[model samples]
Target chain A: MPSPSSTKPKVSALGSFIVIVWLMVLAVAAFLATVVPEIDTLLGRSHLDRTVISAAQAAIAITTVVLLILALSIMKEVYIGRKLR
Target chain B: MLQAITVVLYGAIVSAVSFFAVYFLVPVMIKRLVASGHVVQDYHKPDKPKVPRPAGPALMAGIAASEIILYILTLDSSVLAILFTTAIAFVVGLVDDRKVMPGWFKPGALLLAAIPIIVLGAHPDHLNLIFGRVFIPLLYIPLVFIVIPIAGNTINSIDVLNGVASGFLIIATIPLLVSIAIFGNQDTFLAALPLLFTTLAFYKYHKFPSRIFPGDSGTVLLGALFGALAVAGSSEIIGVIVLLPAVMNSFLFLASVKKIIEHRQVKARPVTLLGDFRLAASKDKSAPITLVRLILADGPLGEREIGIQIFKLAVFAAIMALASIGIQYYFLKDVIR
Candidate 1:
């Protein structure tokens, strides 16, 4: 029976957290591109190989998809054993 | 001149085909859904208004047909990829509409929908940035899997009110089309037109006091296509920026509820209807937060007013998206080869 007005702060906190998370991701992606050598530049060196970049990208991609899929599974069970509302 | 005119005329034919398909079929769909008892009650009203709920099939048919025509004209692999991903998204939604699946099912199933794009060789490995000056390669394929589901769900999450999904899409799509055409992807440009026009046709019936709901099928189909268009056009940044509001709605909902349960599944309602049918924010601590509830925080507002507020935010995001294009063209001007 909590009044609706008091519920604002908690929701606001979550909203701010998510928006910040997205912005942080954007910033990081932009930063990573700035710092890391372009793939072709790295590939031209006798010592450097495309496989290294491919492996890194694959690792990041797979980990993100895995984490997201896991999140979805957890959300489904949030109200576990409860009847459909 | 003649060839340009031919493409123009052909584009017109494609637009007409898409528009009329959704336009003519929606009324029949409303009748059929109502007759078949596939309806949902509008809880905000005292009358407990019931609305037909099968606009998805009509939308899917229109989009599929128009995209096929675009593919016929261009023989673009990207065009075909868009059609398949969208149809798959629609079917995934239909599964939910026919019978409730666990909250995870649709998102999980949508992952497979990205396969057609990859298998068709439509997605390329390279990220365009700083006006196409900065290229990050080897990121596209993995990102494709993430983009499809996120887009489908974001669109689904924003369909809380009547016409919001289709209307918001019209605004969100303007920049997508602009950026695609300017970026010189003729096939994706032509492919995207059908989506814009299709949503325009559906918005006619989906607007306030709606006769029918887009349901999960309509929303997810549109969402997936929007994402697919971005992927195909190689304009993921533009699409993401244009859809920021809907993405925020998804983020806000998930962060608040800490789960993926349906809106109807929430124990406490986010907004409460007053005697005048104006919706006010819910005070219950247990009620999950939503964009509507957050908007209602200042005071109670009618459903129409709330819908307008969401549109206003979407337009602002569209402008921001357009600005990114401006930045690209200005800073990346030399790369306009």
Candidate 2:
């Protein structure tokens, strides 16, 4: 393993590479925003659109519900009879 | 379907590219600048052994680049609300990282950072439902002040262990991406996806027994991202939930440290002497042990012991994640169907 001092040059190089990637992304987003249609018809934009939206909402809703249940369940198991940790 | 999916996929690609490009650039520039001025400025040289040279400047530079890309891509008042809140935090952290600002100044900086969210209408509110009333906003501005900074510090706290804070970053963004897909918030999703990808890539260097520490800049970036995403999604409660792991860890760490300091003060009798001794003793400790001392000094434990404590925290967080998923399932399964 490289010592701490030895790591800086490698990190700096990686940082440079990340910056290049970021610029490329900007270029692509710009190009796509201009050249490609905002909504795609072939995939039946309306249907997939709703599906995507539902997926997003469901994911959040599910995540929220799941976390609460898990936390409560764990709390009940770990700290129920005993005082809270 | 293929075309739309392709477009979304392409958007993800573009986002990833842009975020990395900018994040990498700022650090190099900062490093060069620092190198030029190295003779004048005395870098932090410790009396004790140090681990990796502090990557604080590099992390700050990366944050600056990320913020700049966020601003450029999303525009001045874009939906990437977390970007600016985090930027404010980063600025505060940067000041501290450079000069070790007085302690009270940190909270003051956080309070200052919360202004953008309040001004931008990202304040938290709860509904008061009686009879037919709907969406009645209450106690919002105060809540925004309390919550944003708390969340900001939460991200800062879990950063104790390597790669831990980034784990929260990845977790918190899941919903943002989900919300974007469902609500046709493609613009926001496009913006966030890159940040997520960049963090993942950076994690390669940041994983356990780490190579590079993300430092304050990375933590602030994440906190800012959480804040921005909360505003854009218009779900303050969910925002807090997503960040529960980090927030809880930070809170626990603070309480733990506070208790330790108080205990030490009591032991040392003259409470003032405790701080003085700690300030002096910090120089004699191992670098990693210093991290433990600063953050987890409720009791003196070895590295393995600290790792266990961290693991317990992670498991605790993982449970929270699972619960969050369960709760959403209960309320929305029928609707989703």
Candidate 3:
């Protein structure tokens, strides 16, 4: 098996992108939890409104899954087989 | 006063039985499994030693026997549910150890294990976070299903190095046990004591230059039990924070791989070997990202040294978990109460 270069691994552009996106997703989740509830109330919705809660829940879930897919596609070839020269 | 004494006696008895069970049963399993040609090459060692594979049955026997004694002394449905979940995970892993199942086998099968907790109704709909408690309500049921598979796999992913799984497990378990005590859940504390004793005992042979491997059965079973205990104790967030290192390892691997697959099935080795047998980070961009690979990013290190680094990371995460307890206190006046 070909060996990896014995050097420090500088953060890849992809790594930075993943980190940034992950933080953004977390921020979005927080927004949904704190801000989105207030938004619902402003719109004449009660605190127990299932519609508002599930909508935020769906948004968070979809955002997370989409980011995961993007990460996989970015690193797909790199992860599966060693493209050693 | 009499009840206190009996509780102490039960704790001592359960621990002793658990310790002895693994201490004795392991050697027998080693002899039997090695004799049956079930040994695998210890590729990480310089000499490439052959070690008996997957002594999970012995560990499970120790745990099950200890749990049975506890139930006999104090019948707790939560205790039985945890035991059943862990045993199911063990069987899921045992199948993989004995035969090559498809990659989906372990994860798919472990979902069944979570059913016991749901069926026992041991988990509440409320989750305690660092800031405050949140009521997941109906979502907690789905969370159980997600947690079991993730827990089983996350711990299994960290079993890459000798003694890493058991040692990390022992380190990670302390906070949970502490939380249980703080909550004054004495019955649950007694139930959890044997788990600690069994894993601690297994480490005697499971440390560097391991005499035997925990295999899938051991890792998955241990992981499942860890998760179950977290749910049963209502300390899921604490458990996750304490296990952040292992959880990070699992996430890095899964995110890199883009799918559910076993480490055994991977073609690209994450860490490559140097002439001295120390593992160096693979410059191969194609290599799967892993905790060990990231650890070696600066340079190659000895296997035992790498194990120490991982343990240190776990300890650091555990301290963070402890800090979160303070956060919980700050948010909720009666945190444990």
Candidate 4:
């Protein structure tokens, strides 16, 4: 398992990082989805309560981030193998 | 109304992310595949010989990864209707990427991919045709799947150049996004906006003489995303029309491949270069066409020139997108109320 390269693959690594951060964001969102329970309570008491659209959006975002990580991990694996070969 | 909007927007964003993710990862995947010995590296061919070694497998890895992610995300969010459709499209692409299937099998897969949408409440209820007094069925399930996958594969074929395939996709999406805006489909607007942006970013690196190629990953992603969006837009006829540009490009490439193959057989040569654009040449041709020469040439429009031509057609697709919207407004506008 060679470390990811800092050359041509740097951009891909950047994408991987984006996905990683996105994953964190999604985790926080899913947590918030359970913790808040109600849209009004979530928004009135917390900073994230804006619209039902927002929560649904967070769900979509989290899902996308998770997907992004899956894509990037594939990329990372491919990139490292290519670089080494 | 709000919930509907959210759903549409979610679809659009997912489409966008799906497209770019595939585009970005394909090159790396190719490198990996080459390394893993799953695919062999063709180094003997001239043109960009020094750019590491990965090639075909990268395309597969990128495509497979993106599709899996797409399916997972769809299940996670319960966007079931489009999920299975995309999965079918992905498998079709995967098969195409791995090995050539029988000609009929390809079309069969396309039809299969179109099933989920047709069955799970995704069909467009509006029908429009050129001739008067001809009653076309609103639930045109057969045509939808048949044509959509054909369109998808066509776009995939034409996507040989950098920026060309993605460029056409962005162009096609603009009108869809606009239609959503005018008709007040806010959710779709939010989701699809990112597609435009991500594709643009990809274009920056993908344009002619590209640093990287989209390969199968990019092509399959574009195909599925476009198919899903067209269906999700609920403006099927127009979506099909807007995609005509890609249709033309793909046709041209297909013709070229056919001619090249036929010429090779007729000449009894190892390779035959069609016209001046030498993808592969007949064994007898003294000056066989090469990919490098075709890319670098000023005249004798080869794949590069054809790619740009396809882009021009995409600009025209904007009109088709608008027309589709208008037609949708005529039929479905009242339903939403």
Better of 3 and 4 by TM-score: 3
lDDT of 3 by residue, B1-337 (tens): 1278887898899999998999999989999989999899988787889999898999999999998888887878888988899999999999988898887888899999999999998777776655555556677898899889889988899999889999999999888887666543667778788778899999998999899999999999999988888888877777777777787688778877778888878898899878777788788776788878877766777788778888877777667677666655566566455
| Regions more than 4 Å wrong, model 4 | A1-85, B3-31, B37-78, B128-139, B180-205, B250-299, B302-306, B323-337
lDDT of 1 by residue, A1-85 (tens): 1123322222233234334434443444454445444544555565656677656545654565466545634543342212113
Model 2: DockQ vs. true structure: 0.02
- Cα error, candidate 4, residue B217 (Å): 5.2
Model 3 over residues A8-77: C-alpha lDDT tens digits?
A: 4332432443344334433443443455445445645555576666666556545665775566445533
Candidate number with greatest DockQ: 3
CAPRI tier of model 4: incorrect
Residue B259 displacement in candidate 3 (angstroms)? 1.4
Summarize candidate 1's per-residue lDDT along B212-255 as a digit string, tens digits. Answer: 89988999989999888888776787788788778867866787
Q: Which consecutive 10 residues in model 1 chain B have the weakest lDDT in total?
A: B129-138
Worst lDDT run of 10 residues, candidate 3 chain A, spans: A76-85
Give the interface RMSD values of the models in order.
8.9, 18.0, 7.5, 20.9
Q: What is the TM-score of each candidate against the true structure?
A: 0.84, 0.55, 0.84, 0.55
Alpha carbon lDDT at B269, candidate 3: 89
Indicate which candidate wins on lDDT: 3
Ranking the candidates on DockQ from highest down gives 3, 1, 2, 4
All models, RMSD in angstroms: 6.2, 15.1, 5.1, 19.7
**Stronger candidate by DockQ (3 vs 4):** 3
**What's the residue-level lDDT of B329 in candidate 1?**
63
Off by over 4 Å in 3: A1-85, B1-6
Better of 1 and 4 by TM-score: 1
